[model samples]
Target chain A: MRLFHGQRAWVLQRLTALVVLLLLALTAATLLIGPAPSYERWHALATSAPGAVLIVIFFAALCGHAWVGVRDIVLDYIQPTALRLPLLALIAFILIAITLRVTLTMATHFTVGA
Target chain B: MPAPPRAAPKFLNLAQIRFPIGAIASIGHRISGVLLLISLPFLVLALERSLRSEADYAALGTWLNSPWRALLLVVMVWAATHHLLAGVRHMLMDIGIGSRLAQARMSAWSTIVAALLIALLAAMRWLS
Candidate 1:
């Protein structure tokens, strides 16, 4: 029996890619079409419910998408299982830390009038 | 029967290979993905700093004024644009939209052109 089948991974990668695409477009529009990057405008946007939701979704999808892509590259090039496992773990740790930091920052800083 | 002669090992010469446009675009996708991954920490730090306060935001703005920071921002803009365009192409291919050889090549070229144009615009906006 095969230990790993790539079909599910491929499908999930595409799904997360789609999410990232939409969210990235939304973000670019917000930054470019809206007001210049100022604290007040940015704060207002980040504090709003919709803005916060979009940001959360964007970061989550981005993390998922990056993880899949990075894992593929690491597997392709890294020969030694020992080295590869450690590198993958390190990358996963970094991505998870970033996701947590962004989520926590958004949750705490963008609260209802701080 | 005598044992078959061992096949001669062929070494890959990186400088001699000619990669097609589609291959270049595909490689760019991976390169940009890696770049974005590595830059995430710095990007997040900047985002957090800018959101801290008006003073912090202003300081972040000042930080962008340095030539090196400006250059890094340009590279990031290029990476983002290239990755976005290449990703869309990959998605379309997945959906059987542009999987044909001619169509794939066209999309690859378009991705490069569009990404560069967008990156140029971003560079101008950020620098000037």
Candidate 2:
């Protein structure tokens, strides 16, 4: 059975990948080039509205990219439909949960910090 | 004259194959992708803790500074760097920039070398 076939998944993977790459580089650069690492700075960056929103976007992209990547791998190595379907479903659940948790965490913090 | 029949190889032997540099980079991409996926929950846990409170942030920092986690971080840094570089290489190839064999091999080698160097830098920065 084709789990995540077609051009749409392929395009999703690449697009999400670019988003993740750019955001990660931005975050890394800010951490490295700015003042010494500290809890205050990190908290501020994470809780700021724009920062929090960007972070949420970053994680969303990450989950999307991961789902596609993992689905491809599972489809490739796992032969049995019984095993593969369950495995893909598990991964999908995990990614969705991660996305929700991150969004909630950022939302809570942003609201409190504002 | 009819050719003599020969039996086909029954099993594929992975050990006998020498992977090309590009193939090595390609596999590294998949491996690193999976590793990053496995580590995501823990990473998000850290992010949550770090944002929860100053005390929690400090606690998480201390935990990360420990020897074992430091090692794991090094591995993660390498994985992230390699995955990023190889992914960019793939994207460029998709756009027809590095589709040639020589250029592809060069990019693959560069990706691996650059990722290692960046990871080494992170290790020094963190472990020192």
Per-prediction DockQ: 0.84, 0.85
What digit string (tens of lDDT, one per residue) describes model 1 on residues B22-95? Answer: 99998889999999988888878887887788999888877877777787888888898899889888988888
The residue pairs that clash in candidate 1, if any, are: none
**What lDDT tens digits, residue by residue, belong to model 1 across residues A1-114?**
763349877887889889988877787787867567778888888867777667777788788889889889988989899899889899889889888888887887766653
Instruction: Point to the candidate with the largest lDDT.
Output: 2
The global Cα lDDT (0 to 1) of model 2 is 0.89
Q: Candidate 2 regions off by >4 Å?
A: A1-3, B1-11
Weakest 10 consecutive residues of candidate 1 chain B by summed lDDT? B2-11
Pairs that collide in candidate 2 are: none
Fnat computed for model 1? 0.94
TM-score of predicted structure 2? 0.90
| Chain A TM-score, structure 2 | 0.89
